[model samples]
Target: MSINIINRSGHPLPAYQTAHAAGMDVYAHLPAEPVTLGPLQRALIPTGLFLEIPEGYEAQVRPRSGLAYRHGIGIVNSPGTIDADYRGELKVLLVNLSDTDFVVQDGERIAQLVVARHERVAWQAAEELSETQRGAGGYGSTGTK
Candidate 1:
Protein backbone atom coordinates (compact mmCIF):
# COMPACT_ATOMS: atom_id res chain seq x y z
CA MET A 1 0.00 0.00 0.00
CA SER A 2 1.25 3.45 -0.92
CA ILE A 3 1.19 6.29 1.60
CA ASN A 4 1.64 10.04 1.32
CA ILE A 5 4.35 11.37 3.60
CA ILE A 6 6.33 14.57 4.14
CA ASN A 7 9.88 14.35 5.43
CA ARG A 8 11.44 17.39 7.07
CA SER A 9 14.07 15.73 9.26
CA GLY A 10 16.74 15.75 6.56
CA HIS A 11 17.06 12.01 7.11
CA PRO A 12 16.01 9.26 4.79
CA LEU A 13 12.37 8.21 4.83
CA PRO A 14 11.30 5.45 7.15
CA ALA A 15 11.72 2.09 5.46
CA TYR A 16 11.34 -1.60 6.09
CA GLN A 17 14.61 -3.17 7.27
CA THR A 18 14.11 -6.54 5.61
CA ALA A 19 12.39 -8.02 2.61
CA HIS A 20 9.26 -9.07 4.46
CA ALA A 21 9.22 -6.75 7.45
CA ALA A 22 5.73 -5.63 8.39
CA GLY A 23 6.71 -2.39 10.07
CA MET A 24 8.86 0.42 8.80
CA ASP A 25 11.63 1.54 11.12
CA VAL A 26 11.19 5.18 12.14
CA TYR A 27 14.04 7.58 12.85
CA ALA A 28 14.43 10.08 15.67
CA HIS A 29 14.76 13.68 14.58
CA LEU A 30 16.88 15.16 17.31
CA PRO A 31 19.69 17.64 17.60
CA ALA A 32 23.37 16.85 17.12
CA GLU A 33 23.84 16.45 20.85
CA PRO A 34 21.92 13.46 22.08
CA VAL A 35 18.93 13.60 24.39
CA THR A 36 19.65 11.69 27.58
CA LEU A 37 16.92 9.85 29.39
CA GLY A 38 17.75 8.93 32.95
CA PRO A 39 16.38 5.81 34.52
CA LEU A 40 12.56 5.91 34.56
CA GLN A 41 12.57 9.01 32.40
CA ARG A 42 10.30 9.51 29.42
CA ALA A 43 10.50 11.90 26.48
CA LEU A 44 8.73 12.70 23.24
CA ILE A 45 10.96 11.93 20.28
CA PRO A 46 9.92 13.51 17.00
CA THR A 47 10.39 12.06 13.52
CA GLY A 48 9.67 15.16 11.40
CA LEU A 49 7.22 13.03 9.44
CA PHE A 50 3.68 13.79 8.46
CA LEU A 51 1.56 11.01 7.06
CA GLU A 52 -1.74 10.97 5.23
CA ILE A 53 -3.16 7.63 6.16
CA PRO A 54 -6.09 6.29 4.18
CA GLU A 55 -9.53 6.10 5.66
CA GLY A 56 -10.26 3.05 7.84
CA TYR A 57 -6.54 2.70 8.48
CA GLU A 58 -4.14 3.72 11.21
CA ALA A 59 -0.46 3.81 11.98
CA GLN A 60 0.76 1.78 14.90
CA VAL A 61 3.87 3.11 16.60
CA ARG A 62 5.68 0.36 18.43
CA PRO A 63 8.89 -0.05 20.41
CA ARG A 64 12.07 -1.52 19.04
CA SER A 65 12.63 -4.95 20.58
CA GLY A 66 16.40 -4.67 20.55
CA LEU A 67 16.35 -1.34 22.40
CA ALA A 68 13.94 -2.75 24.94
CA TYR A 69 16.02 -5.85 25.56
CA ARG A 70 19.44 -4.18 25.57
CA HIS A 71 18.77 -0.80 27.17
CA GLY A 72 15.35 -1.23 28.74
CA ILE A 73 14.02 1.43 26.39
CA GLY A 74 10.45 1.18 25.28
CA ILE A 75 7.51 3.17 24.12
CA VAL A 76 5.32 4.62 26.85
CA ASN A 77 2.32 3.61 24.80
CA SER A 78 3.26 0.35 23.18
CA PRO A 79 1.60 0.37 19.78
CA GLY A 80 0.50 3.96 19.94
CA THR A 81 -2.30 4.66 17.45
CA ILE A 82 -2.32 7.28 14.75
CA ASP A 83 -5.69 7.87 13.21
CA ALA A 84 -6.20 8.40 9.50
CA ASP A 85 -7.30 12.00 9.92
CA TYR A 86 -4.28 13.06 11.88
CA ARG A 87 -2.07 15.56 10.03
CA GLY A 88 0.69 16.35 12.48
CA GLU A 89 4.26 15.30 13.02
CA LEU A 90 4.96 11.76 14.10
CA LYS A 91 6.37 11.64 17.60
CA VAL A 92 7.27 8.72 19.79
CA LEU A 93 6.83 8.50 23.55
CA LEU A 94 9.99 6.79 24.77
CA VAL A 95 10.73 5.71 28.30
CA ASN A 96 13.94 4.41 29.86
CA LEU A 97 13.30 1.52 32.20
CA SER A 98 16.88 0.62 33.02
CA ASP A 99 19.03 1.85 35.90
CA THR A 100 21.34 3.93 33.69
CA ASP A 101 20.87 6.77 31.26
CA PHE A 102 20.27 6.18 27.54
CA VAL A 103 21.16 8.69 24.89
CA VAL A 104 18.83 9.28 21.94
CA GLN A 105 20.88 10.28 18.94
CA ASP A 106 19.71 12.09 15.83
CA GLY A 107 18.36 9.78 13.11
CA GLU A 108 18.32 6.89 15.58
CA ARG A 109 15.89 4.09 14.99
CA ILE A 110 13.75 4.46 18.08
CA ALA A 111 10.49 3.01 16.91
CA GLN A 112 8.66 1.04 14.21
CA LEU A 113 5.51 2.10 12.40
CA VAL A 114 3.03 -0.39 11.08
CA VAL A 115 0.29 0.94 8.83
CA ALA A 116 -2.78 -1.25 9.16
CA ARG A 117 -6.42 -1.41 8.20
CA HIS A 118 -9.03 -1.45 10.95
CA GLU A 119 -12.76 -1.78 11.20
CA ARG A 120 -15.21 0.54 12.88
CA VAL A 121 -17.62 -1.40 15.01
CA ALA A 122 -21.18 -0.41 15.61
CA TRP A 123 -22.32 -0.78 19.21
CA GLN A 124 -25.18 -3.20 19.75
CA ALA A 125 -25.99 -2.67 23.40
CA ALA A 126 -27.31 -5.78 24.98
CA GLU A 127 -28.09 -7.05 28.44
CA GLU A 128 -25.05 -9.29 28.73
CA LEU A 129 -22.62 -11.37 26.72
CA SER A 130 -22.84 -15.11 26.13
CA GLU A 131 -21.39 -17.52 28.67
CA THR A 132 -18.22 -19.53 28.37
CA GLN A 133 -16.53 -22.24 30.45
CA ARG A 134 -14.07 -19.70 31.82
CA GLY A 135 -16.52 -16.86 31.88
CA ALA A 136 -15.40 -13.57 33.44
CA GLY A 137 -11.99 -15.01 34.04
CA GLY A 138 -9.56 -12.18 34.60
CA TYR A 139 -5.80 -12.27 34.22
CA GLY A 140 -3.99 -15.56 34.90
CA SER A 141 -7.22 -17.44 35.25
CA THR A 142 -5.86 -20.16 33.01
CA GLY A 143 -2.81 -21.45 34.79
CA THR A 144 0.49 -22.28 33.12
CA LYS A 145 0.30 -26.06 33.13
Candidate 2:
Protein backbone atom coordinates (compact mmCIF):
# COMPACT_ATOMS: atom_id res chain seq x y z
CA MET A 1 0.00 0.00 0.00
CA SER A 2 1.25 3.44 -0.93
CA ILE A 3 1.07 6.25 1.60
CA ASN A 4 0.77 9.95 0.83
CA ILE A 5 3.43 12.06 2.55
CA ILE A 6 4.46 15.70 2.69
CA ASN A 7 8.13 16.21 3.40
CA ARG A 8 9.25 19.72 4.25
CA SER A 9 12.67 18.86 5.66
CA GLY A 10 14.50 19.05 2.32
CA HIS A 11 15.95 15.62 3.13
CA PRO A 12 15.43 12.31 1.46
CA LEU A 13 12.20 10.49 2.20
CA PRO A 14 12.23 7.66 4.73
CA ALA A 15 13.06 4.37 3.07
CA TYR A 16 13.79 0.82 4.07
CA GLN A 17 17.47 -0.07 4.02
CA THR A 18 17.00 -3.75 3.33
CA ALA A 19 14.52 -5.81 1.37
CA HIS A 20 12.84 -7.28 4.44
CA ALA A 21 13.19 -4.26 6.73
CA ALA A 22 9.88 -3.70 8.45
CA GLY A 23 10.58 -0.10 9.49
CA MET A 24 11.97 2.91 7.68
CA ASP A 25 14.49 5.22 9.28
CA VAL A 26 13.20 8.71 10.12
CA TYR A 27 15.43 11.76 10.31
CA ALA A 28 15.49 14.89 12.45
CA HIS A 29 14.63 18.20 10.82
CA LEU A 30 16.52 20.48 13.13
CA PRO A 31 17.90 23.93 12.55
CA ALA A 32 21.55 24.86 12.24
CA GLU A 33 22.12 24.68 15.98
CA PRO A 34 22.32 21.29 17.61
CA VAL A 35 19.97 20.42 20.44
CA THR A 36 21.54 19.05 23.62
CA LEU A 37 19.89 16.60 25.98
CA GLY A 38 21.22 16.38 29.50
CA PRO A 39 21.10 13.24 31.57
CA LEU A 40 17.57 11.87 31.82
CA GLN A 41 16.33 14.80 29.73
CA ARG A 42 13.61 14.50 27.15
CA ALA A 43 12.78 16.52 24.06
CA LEU A 44 10.21 16.56 21.29
CA ILE A 45 12.05 16.54 17.99
CA PRO A 46 10.20 17.24 14.76
CA THR A 47 10.60 15.51 11.42
CA GLY A 48 8.99 18.24 9.26
CA LEU A 49 7.00 15.55 7.56
CA PHE A 50 3.28 14.90 7.45
CA LEU A 51 1.69 11.61 6.52
CA GLU A 52 -1.75 10.56 5.43
CA ILE A 53 -2.09 6.97 6.48
CA PRO A 54 -4.85 4.90 4.98
CA GLU A 55 -7.78 3.79 7.05
CA GLY A 56 -7.31 0.59 9.08
CA TYR A 57 -3.59 1.29 9.16
CA GLU A 58 -1.36 3.20 11.59
CA ALA A 59 2.15 4.50 11.73
CA GLN A 60 4.32 3.63 14.72
CA VAL A 61 7.36 5.53 15.89
CA ARG A 62 10.06 3.37 17.46
CA PRO A 63 13.59 3.90 18.76
CA ARG A 64 16.65 2.97 16.79
CA SER A 65 18.62 0.18 18.38
CA GLY A 66 21.97 1.83 17.67
CA LEU A 67 21.02 5.01 19.47
CA ALA A 68 19.50 3.18 22.41
CA TYR A 69 22.44 0.82 22.78
CA ARG A 70 25.33 3.18 22.09
CA HIS A 71 24.15 6.57 23.35
CA GLY A 72 21.46 5.55 25.81
CA ILE A 73 18.92 7.49 23.76
CA GLY A 74 15.40 6.23 23.15
CA ILE A 75 11.87 7.33 22.58
CA VAL A 76 10.07 7.97 25.84
CA ASN A 77 6.97 6.29 24.46
CA SER A 78 8.30 3.55 22.29
CA PRO A 79 5.97 2.45 19.51
CA GLY A 80 4.03 5.71 19.58
CA THR A 81 1.02 5.56 17.29
CA ILE A 82 0.16 8.08 14.57
CA ASP A 83 -3.49 7.70 13.82
CA ALA A 84 -4.64 7.57 10.24
CA ASP A 85 -6.66 10.71 10.75
CA TYR A 86 -3.80 12.76 12.11
CA ARG A 87 -2.46 15.41 9.74
CA GLY A 88 0.25 17.05 11.81
CA GLU A 89 3.99 17.01 11.62
CA LEU A 90 5.61 13.82 12.84
CA LYS A 91 7.52 14.38 16.07
CA VAL A 92 9.63 12.05 18.12
CA LEU A 93 9.76 12.04 21.90
CA LEU A 94 13.38 11.36 22.68
CA VAL A 95 14.92 10.84 26.10
CA ASN A 96 18.50 10.50 27.24
CA LEU A 97 18.97 7.80 29.82
CA SER A 98 22.74 8.18 30.23
CA ASP A 99 24.78 10.32 32.62
CA THR A 100 26.26 12.45 29.84
CA ASP A 101 24.79 14.86 27.35
CA PHE A 102 23.75 13.95 23.84
CA VAL A 103 23.60 16.18 20.78
CA VAL A 104 20.94 16.01 18.09
CA GLN A 105 21.99 17.13 14.63
CA ASP A 106 20.03 18.13 11.59
CA GLY A 107 18.97 15.32 9.24
CA GLU A 108 20.17 12.77 11.75
CA ARG A 109 18.47 9.41 11.87
CA ILE A 110 16.44 9.59 15.06
CA ALA A 111 13.83 6.87 14.92
CA GLN A 112 12.04 4.28 12.83
CA LEU A 113 8.59 4.44 11.29
CA VAL A 114 6.62 1.24 10.94
CA VAL A 115 3.32 1.24 9.10
CA ALA A 116 1.03 -1.57 10.17
CA ARG A 117 -2.52 -2.60 9.60
CA HIS A 118 -4.74 -2.94 12.66
CA GLU A 119 -8.18 -4.22 13.35
CA ARG A 120 -10.91 -2.52 15.30
CA VAL A 121 -12.73 -4.50 17.97
CA ALA A 122 -16.29 -4.02 19.08
CA TRP A 123 -17.49 -4.50 22.61
CA GLN A 124 -18.89 -7.94 23.21
CA ALA A 125 -19.74 -7.63 26.87
CA ALA A 126 -20.20 -10.95 28.58
CA GLU A 127 -21.15 -11.93 32.09
CA GLU A 128 -17.91 -13.79 32.68
CA LEU A 129 -14.80 -14.60 30.71
CA SER A 130 -13.94 -18.19 29.93
CA GLU A 131 -11.41 -19.96 32.16
CA THR A 132 -8.17 -21.63 31.16
CA GLN A 133 -5.27 -23.55 32.75
CA ARG A 134 -3.28 -20.32 33.17
CA GLY A 135 -6.24 -18.07 33.88
CA ALA A 136 -5.50 -14.82 35.72
CA GLY A 137 -1.77 -15.61 35.61
CA GLY A 138 0.36 -12.58 34.74
CA TYR A 139 3.64 -10.77 35.43
CA GLY A 140 6.19 -13.56 35.48
CA SER A 141 3.58 -16.19 36.26
CA THR A 142 5.25 -18.37 33.66
CA GLY A 143 8.50 -18.22 35.69
CA THR A 144 12.07 -17.63 34.57
CA LYS A 145 15.32 -19.38 35.29
- Candidate 1 TM-score versus the reference: 0.95
Each model's TM-score, in the order given? 0.95, 0.96
Task: State which candidate has the highest TM-score.
Answer: 2
RMSD of each: 1.2, 1.1
Model 1 spans with C-alpha error above 4 angstroms: none
Structural RMSD, model 1: 1.2
- Candidate 2 residue-wise lDDT, 22-133, digit = tens: 9999999997677899999999999999999999999999999999999999999998999999999999999999999999999999999999999999999899999997
Q: Global CA lDDT of candidate 1, please?
A: 0.94
lDDT of 1 by residue, 1-145 (tens): 8899999999889899999999889999986567999999999999999999999999999999999999999999999999999999999999999999999999999999999999999999999999998898889988945
